[model samples]
Target: MNNTALLKPETARDEVYAAPLKDLNPAQPALFQANTMFSIFERLRAEDPVHYTPESDFGAFWSVTKYKDIMAVDTNHEVFSSEGGITIGDQPMEEGPLPMFIAMDPPKHDIQRKTVTPAVSPMNLARLEPLIRERAGKILDGLPIGEEFDWVDKVSMELTAMTLATLFGIPQEDRRKLTYWSDVVTAAPGQGLIDTLDQKFEIFVEYHAYFTELWNQRVNADPQPDLISMLAHGEATRNMEPREYFGNVVLLTVGGNDTTRNTISGSVLALNQNPDQYKKLRENPDLIPSMVSETIRWQTPLAHMRRRALQDIELGGKQIKKGDKVVMWYVSGNRDDEVIENPNDYIIDRPRVRNHLSFGFGIHRCVGNRLAELQLKVIWEEILKRFPTVEVAGEPKRSYSTFVRGYERLPVIIPSRL
Candidate 1:
């Protein structure tokens, strides 16, 4: 929680590796915020791939690092259940869980997930592309040249907010509220976003009330392309309990926001860090699709997804007891040397770039993946057409949460217009 005063890289790595394997805990939000968990995950992947920490901010849980091991956990939804929830930390006991499809199992998860899938289907995305490109162009055109600006705020968030508003059928004017609610849902107490868990609930109440009005409106009207209308008209989700609706709302908002938003920021930062790859992109624009996938692998926006053990299982030679929390670090798995070649470097044109753990595997794979790619592809295409270069002018401030691996701010400069 707000713990990243920005640790020195060498010291952070040394401290993490020096600690005993038994005492290592990668779930701490501070490690993520400081961007120091790379070393922790590195040690865990090397020594204890299926690691258990007796004590943590979230309590005793198992960390599943490495590429193949993460795939095993993510794909085997039956043995590694999502019903216990998809994050290492438990929700407030009083609030209970807001049940969304991502946290459900089997028949129920399939039904609810199917209800909202059409809104982001390939056909719908093709229909939405021209509009998205137009918006991306407008955003790029509006950016001030020869001055430093936060790409996260001025570009990444704005573009994603506009696209999210279009998908949810909300006014573009209310887009920032979507960002706020999404942030609050992932925020921890004392993280600056929220002071306490109660405050988070209060924001949830506001979020619920706002979205409920939209749901009622959609339910009363005929079916349309927006997500609200789909949920209201779909046979499975039409009569969902109010809290369940809110849960899906939370899910969709974060789903749409984080992957695209963070990856957009990450793409900019990564390209800046590796100028050679950025130069390759300038010479060959066709690499955008491959570059998008590379950045997704490079970023792994949502770092980890948690699952619960259905029965006692031995994974990577560790005995995982029934009901234990198993956290699959997708971020770490993307870095496993045995799987991805030159895993630490940002290579935009890497072979089999799409074959990464960023969007996950199996049934729980991200629903909005293609749309995320479409947005990135269009933005980069438009970006190349106008600006010669968008340079990262200063260091980025990463988000506070362990769940959302994203930037709070990334300052950039548009040196000139093409």
Candidate 2:
């Protein structure tokens, strides 16, 4: 679909947000293209925080816009079930239920989640920190000093892919395959990665076979510290069905890839766009942790997570029927003025910095969030130690999906050293 056509006249760009609440459709790709998603979210937060869209390419769904409502829905997993799926787009029925823990309800979700939590436990992150700093240093030291480059490619994806490879115990030579499969998992046809469902399926089969080989290698070996090993030896996860195993792999890949990579890219773009905040960070390098939190909130790597109502419920003055699709717009929630002071502004020193919906809320919140934050913090620390200023050379090209709030490319130039 040509989203640009939805915006008939570029002259009326301002009016896009002024459309009636009932007529407003946040799912249209044009809003993100115009970079006017904030305005739509602003309107929804004020007038219809729990707004419902009757039609969309995905389906009819309710949009939960405010931070409070999003939290309410997110935390109450029993009432707002995740069993249907995490994103708004329903999985193709022919592919069967990808029973990854993220989409499971209750005992199963808890069990599978426990199996992998140790990989990201505080002790593990502490052990991984020095290695992350080493990798970050090397990556930054290798960047071209004065020439323009795609920050998303040269830095963001590279670092995240390297870290993911470490987490999965994938051989360094074969690590790029993880990145390839991760992109394919979230990509829609014509999204610049895969062009058709058949191509996607082909890649899916390849991904499954590759992981199966890894699983076989680890299933019999002495227990290791990697994700595949954890799943292989875990009492709860060891006997998972084929589709369930594939689903877990997809969950870990997409979860780990999108959050960290996009934030890395988004941090640069955000700081560049907000020069004052950038200046503040350079002056006080200690602000990196706060800046990381603010960037995650501002970027909202994943835009929304969908839920299916298990029972009829009333929320935000609207009645949601049983089995209705409800989407918690984290992008919108992070910018909600009632919750976040100066929500539109990117302030690295903002108080209560961690108070945002980026990592999500409740039991289903991202398990790898601390590791994601650690990578961002370490990269920024290394970036500041090297370049005094990393300038945005051009506008960013964002991912086509409303689900992944991220960049496909971010052009940047580093102006000498500090």
Candidate 3:
């Protein structure tokens, strides 16, 4: 019942963490810069691959920096539970508890994941490729020529929202709401347009109302081939509680919005920054698959995922007690020198590109990874077909939160109709 007890230990750890934070500067204006947190990650990965930071805004957490450590923890899910929650810091929600598959450990996690796996299978995604491509084409067709535009708003957000709209069978007009709800839900403590606590609840209330309507409609309507229909009609899903259903919707909405949106915006930014790689991609469009993987790696959009130690464990030479919070720094691990060669450079044809931890690793890896790639590849191909040049017209800005790395605004100029 005492929050102060929690505060004392964390404050002590802060003194230790801050000492090193002062010596090392890993912040990069382009790659990572909003806060000096990432700089600390880069420092620890170099000095101590598996380091513990006693103090953080989220309380004390162990920062897992190496690629191997992250994979080891992720694969050994039995010892490290996802059920305590997947967030590193304290969550803002006052709801009793949120139901998300990402927050459940095995058994429950396995069962929950199975409920929606059918909808995202490789075969299902292949069947939807043509539809994704058609949507990508329409998105690119609407962009203005020779004038600077915010690519994040116009292209990246639109592509992701449209693809999700198709997947959920959400009407076109309501698609933007997906982006809104996702921002409010995931908006780290002080980020985004609406910063007040009450404002955050209002947004969630609206999303709940919308999803409630959709759920009621889907329950009565003929079974369609979309995700909503799949969840509604599936026998497994019938066992889910109302909160669980709400959790799935929230997960799907956030998953659909942030990851894909960043990949698209990050891809264009990477291409512009590395013209040589962009030239290679433009010439050999076949390399788009490798490029997509590289872009995910280079961007490392979803920054970190938190895991709770279910039992006492020794990881990377450190002993972790049960209930210890472990934060996997995907952004830092993606650039681990040991796992990735010349990790800082953007290599379009890097052979081991698929080895990156962008989609994460092990059982809880991103469920919509294949779909995200399909959408990115389609959008890139369409852009190449229509425009020969799409260059940054101004400096791009990044989101403030450490969780999701993405461009809040990316100014770009495209030559007249290629």
Q: What TM-score fits each model?
A: 0.97, 0.97, 0.91
Can you write out model 2's per-residue Cα lDDT over 98-145, one digit (the tens) per residue? 778999888889999999999999999999999989988998999998
In order of listing, the candidates' clash counts read 0, 0, 1
**Cα RMSD to the true fold for all candidates:** 1.8, 1.8, 5.3
- Tens digits of per-residue lDDT, candidate 3, 297-404, equal 989888888889988899888999899998888988998889899998999999878989988888999999998898899999899899998999987878766677
- Model 1 agreement with the true structure over 212-313: per-residue lDDT tens digits: 999999999999889999999999999999888988999999999977999999999999999999999999999999999999999999999999999999
Worst 10 residues of 3 by lDDT: 1-10
RMSD score of candidate 2 (Å): 1.8
All candidates' lDDT scores?
0.90, 0.88, 0.80
**Candidate 1 local lDDT, residue 263:** 97
- Distance from true location, Cα of 10 in model 3, Å: 30
What is the alpha-carbon lDDT of model 3 when measured against the actual structure?
0.80
